[model samples]
Target: MKMTKTPIKVRYQETDQMGVVYHANYLVWFEIGRTAFIESLGFNYHDMEQEGIVSPVIDAHMYFKQPIRYGQDAFVKTWIEEYDGLRTTYGYKIEDGEGNAAVTGSTKHVIVKKESFRPVSLRRVFPDWHQAYSDAYKSEE
Candidate 1:
């Protein structure tokens, strides 16, 4: 797998009274990781939007392993776990500064036409981007 790592400094706003990161904030981190992965592939979500394509998360699964406190530096490692013509799954791992996993998750998304909200195949809209995802996913096997 070709993993892209994005470093994040846990901000006070992301934590609770106990100083542990709020559960919902992990999903935001996942978005950050996902955006980074797409950018790393030489494409970006903004361009997709401009082309009238939108990718929305259809499914998400997360596992919390450890607590991350405010002021801690963490990293989100991301990779393309699966990608078909229409649906793509991005996997993510949030690790503390020491490389210990604090959370792991995956988000599945499907490309859609921005106006109609109908599902569309990435291969049809962006062949190069689709191929890049396929190549990256196959590289792990």
Candidate 2:
């Protein structure tokens, strides 16, 4: 499977008084990972929206395994877990500097028309991108 790893440096602001990363910071890291994954595929979310398409997350879930502290470097590994007609599921794993996993997560998103917010099949609108995602995933699309 093709995967992209985006490195994130945990900032002081990302931590609470306890010096551990705030709960919400993982969400931002997920977005960073997603963007890196998209860029790895030679596409960008901003450009996709300019092309009249927008993908919005419909479902998301994250599981925390270990605590990440400020000043620690984290690695977010992202891959396309599934891609069909209108939906794509992305999976992620975050690891600490020691290569120990800190979190595991996945997000499901659907492509829609930017103007109407109606579902659109990426296979029909952007066949190359769709095929790339499909080919990257191992399971049935």
Candidate 3:
């Protein structure tokens, strides 16, 4: 399976009064990881949006193992956890540059028509994209 790694330094602005990263910032980092994964496949999401296809998250989940503070660097590892006809799951791991994990999570998404919001199966409508996903497919199940 293919994976994308993104390194980010936690900034003070990303922290709350507690001095740890704000809970909401992890979601943003997840997005950054996902976007990097998408680009790794040689597809541009901005172009996809212009093509009238919108990939929206149907589900997002994360488990926090440790608190990350400002000035610490984290590496987000992202991979396609699974891809079926109409849905795709992306898995992520936020870690200290070493192997210790800070959080493990996944996001489920489906491509939909920008105007109608109806799900579109990439396998049939866009075989090339589906193939791209297949090459990196992963599943814990």
Q: For residues 54-84, what per-residue lDDT tens digits would candidate 1 score against the true structure?
A: 9999999999999999988899999988888
Instruction: Tell me the tens digit of each residue's lDDT in model 3 across 1-141.
Output: 788899977889999998888888998999999999888888878887887999999999999999888877898999988788699999999987666889889999999999999988888877877888887774231
Q: How much is 118 displaced in model 1, in angstroms? A: 0.3
**What TM-score, over all chains together, does every model reach?**
0.97, 0.94, 0.93
Query: Any residue pairs clashing in model 1, and if so which?
Result: none
User: What lDDT does each candidate get?
Assistant: 0.93, 0.88, 0.87
RMSD of 3: 2.4
Candidate topping TM-score: 1
Which regions in candidate 3 have their CA more than 4 angstroms from the true location? 138-141
Q: Give the CA lDDT, 0 to 100, for residue 56 in model 3.
A: 96
Better of 1 and 2 by TM-score: 1
1-141 per-residue lDDT for model 2 (tens digits):
788889998889999999999878888898999999888878888877889988999999999999999888899999987777788889999999989999989999999998999998899998888877877786442
Give all candidate RMSDs, comma-separated: 1.1, 2.3, 2.4
Candidate order by TM-score, decreasing, is 1, 2, 3
Please give the lDDT score at residue 106 for candidate 1: 99
Best by lDDT: 1
Q: What is the lDDT of candidate 2?
A: 0.88
